[model samples]
Target: MSNYIVRKLKLEKTPQLDHLARAAGELYSRTVVSFWRTVRKKNIWLSGYTMERWHTSSSLHAHSSDAIVQCFYNSLKSWRIRRKTDPHSKPPRRRRWYFKVIWKSAAIKLKGGKLRLSNGQSNSPLIVDWYWEKPSIIELGWNKASQCYELRACYKEEIAQPINDGNVAAVDLGEIHPMVIADGVNTDIFNGRYLRSVRRYQNKLKVRLSKLIDRKKFRSKRRKRSIKSKQKQLAKLNNQIKDIEHKLTSRAVSMLKLRGIQTLVIGDVRDIRNGLDYGKKNNQKLHQWSFGSIRIHLEYKCKKAGIKTVLITEEYTSQECLNCRKRNKPKNRNYRCSCSFEFHRDGVGSNNIRAKYLGIVPVVGLMARPSGLRFHSHIQCNLTDNILLGNPRDSIAGE
Candidate 1:
């Protein structure tokens, strides 16, 4: 529950350090590539991501004479880099070479509390790692050259049962409002106005930058500083948006806990990978509408409170009018159809969201069930390594 980072200074200003780093990067590539190639062949039926089903890789080594050596991490790497070894034979890779590990075994030894320090510095260059006991996974933070720092360590504590008088609130993610929230008992909770403003600023900046480029004035220091300023604004906007979500979501969660709402119900609004783009007019909006990132934040916060999030199928939760039982959701932002049924579009979609605190959805590739509905199609997938949802209070016990 406690979080702090361990930063160890490891700059050689020496060519030996550079050489060790290069060697390690090459070795890391060699090992990861061979593993992934075999993995790809083994899981031919799965998507590249789903290949984690067949084989999930762990770190490998590049041995060195020195017990302490450099380390590396490539966030999104090419498959070719993993296998290619003849440095002179292949074409240049867009992915740049960075830090990598050379003495992993020794590194592990240091991690286990062995004392090998000299000159009051860590004998081995540090590798940033994260361990969360609740969800139970160890993550390695890749070194970020931009800040000259790895995302080393972050302290995010899970609050167990933070409240007991609140009620279950279902927040629907949307295009305009960004977040449309409603308690299980029916109350409005929304946050998205600033998000819209941020979007506009981003668009304006993009247009301005584009104009400068067209005029061939892109090299001006003024333009560069302006762009940087815009980036800072974008970041500030992101923090504002997330802060709103956290406040609302956490309040809802706390309220639910207070009301004896043992389980918190939420929609699994994830990227279905069906070509969803927020229409990138420029660099800003493209980065702002980080769908994947939003979901991740929600999941992590929910996990801290031992809450359950139901990932209802994404096919038609919005359009299928929760009231009339009619599938009339529009692709655009409009909520009303030819029929006179007018409501806050997202609110209506959310009304149908059933508090599914049971097992998995039995039906695959079909419309997701709403909250408080009996679902025989419910089978449970483990959201976290420690928690499981097997029982149901609604009509379907098999759910």
Candidate 2:
């Protein structure tokens, strides 16, 4: 299997590059608006072949134009699926003034230290200084946060053969702990307090900025500047959250690999927000939870390591006691059963998930206490180890 990673390169603003990108964006906007109109008037979704006919009219490389249409088609497809559950779900409607430009492998050329991106036969190609190896795909777009045009280079890498050990682990995801993995013999908890602190700060900052902006007169220069500043601040916080998540997942995968784990079973929480309607604060936290992103990162990272990931329905996995097979609602961070069974809440959930996946009744008595890991920063974590279960053997850095 192959996995792809993206690197962002901020472009040096030039009149020529700006003109080319704006032209491409205009083309994309026109294509989407036109496609939406056709769908509305004829009440029929245009096929890919039909969309390709308009490529000849575009000034961009044929593949680049096709990429824009393909993106619109993909959005429409997602809307179609979402509408099944939410009939009120809106389809692509608002017209974008500017959209990102994409260049497929066929239209990208790297020679010397410069990368060339074709723009069809009539126009000159766009070239940028590139110091790294060539990428499979190149994308150019304006970043509102940084107030600059950025380039994204996508590189595909082959997966390495993973350990063939018969050991398996199950992950229980949560808003508090983020990740808790339990193999038959060991459990590990990755604390998420750092993530929650930044998220809370971001929310407060957003509210404060929004109030400040609201007090200003509409269309005033001060208001516009405040809005721009808010976007930049929030974007930086978002990047920090993303960095933490990536590091947490990477560390989790590393620990699993070190333990010779071959299969990872993850609790599926896909529909957790389907009908959620808690109070304002509670609902906002749930909505902002990045469970889906976590799962995607874990899946792809595990695939790159030749470790298989299995998603199983996690219904009652956290509430049901693995020892007595009885349902007991957990309180706080602990799960206590009347039959004298007690353990960490997240660890219990992971153990139950593991049992569900392996089709075996767990002897919770033999399970080791979960090791705790909390991130001090994206690069380092503080670890509390259980000597009986054995440490991750420094696979993940710990103090």
Candidate 3:
């Protein structure tokens, strides 16, 4: 749960560090793309992409005199090489000789073994510092331009406080009420502004993109502009959603800490996208749910905040009633349980979700609260393993 970030600044009177960072990032991406294309067609192999290919027995680039070769051998034996993959693909990053020699050389040349940045000039040993109680290690990362530089000190904090006795927070992640939180009494709803805004932009983009075809611009120009604009629009929407979710989750988890909520009961929806038949309709709703994205963000954020998250089986959370044990058979957004359990369908589900955390369903392999709460009876739902809905264990259908 502990990771650090390395930040750098550009020398005064020079272009911003952001420019260099962006360039480095782009180069890195280009290199990976080239490597993938080469590897895919079997035009090159592993040696060409890593330190191995940099110094052959006779290759002078490595300065492989007996001493340098021996040094490399010993270094290889002693150093632990960790791997990183391409951000956008299944391909493993090919570590080249330039990275090995250049980084090592830079580190060696740096003052106190830490890299530095100067006026339009690269300095050895990029600088860094440590915060909290995490260990201090010199880690290297690839910048946008594919340059390998040491990322200096990382600031990471461990905020792990033990949960209070028998207290828990039930989190209902959704589209409308971006976050419907039940703290056993008052329900706080974080409005779905992000969702609404994103949907709006998405709709606008579709209309705009369609209209682009009618523009008087040349065919290639129009196509290129259209594609670029579409990508920009999508990225903007995604960032907006992510920012809202990040802020909302962090705020919510922090609230839990204040409330003495020991454990966070998170409802893990397998996939809001899969159950539906794929097409325009499914896509329209899927965009709004962002089920997978939000869940993933929350998982890591909660962990970092030291809040233990318990992912519950979302069986009939959407339909099961809290009062009167009634099954409302939801006709719309509101849940009118058959047994007349009056409340927001989401509220009833949230209650059941929380109950499960309190030991409501144990036999179903649901890792619930260690306390004495138990699962409720008379409900139905599933999507086992997310997609694979197992047989109904409770009286509910598709349990």
Cα displacement (angstroms), candidate 1, residue 63, comes to 13
Superior candidate under lDDT, 1 versus 3: 3
- Candidate 2, residue 176: the lDDT equals 92
Give me the displacement of residue 388 in model 2, in angstroms: 30
**Per-residue lDDT for 1-399 in model 3, tens only?**
453333332223223333433433443334445555666898773333253343332222222122233333343334333213333333344433332112222222234433443222332223333222222322233432222343433345445555553577787777666666676665556667545666777778777876875563666876777766666666666656665665565556666656666777888776655667668865777666765666765666556555677888777777666655545577766666555444565655566778777865312122222211111221122212222111222223322
Runs with alpha carbons beyond 4 Å of true place in candidate 2: 1-4, 29-59, 69-97, 112-114, 120-124, 129-133, 155-165, 378-399
The estimated TM-scores of all candidates read: 0.48, 0.80, 0.59
Give lDDT tens digits, candidate 2, residues 306-362. Answer: 688899999999999878999999978889999898899999999999999889999
User: With candidate 2 superimposed using the best TM-score fit, by how many Å does residue 282's alpha carbon deviate from the native?
Assistant: 2.5
* lDDT for predicted candidate 1 compared with the true structure: 0.42
Poorest 10 consecutive residues of model 2 by lDDT?
Answer: 382-391
lDDT of each: 0.42, 0.82, 0.50
Error of 1 at 165 (Å): 18
Look at candidate 1 and tell me the lDDT of residue 378.
29
User: How far does residue 305 in candidate 3 sit from its true spot (Å)?
Assistant: 2.4
Candidate number of the best TM-score: 2
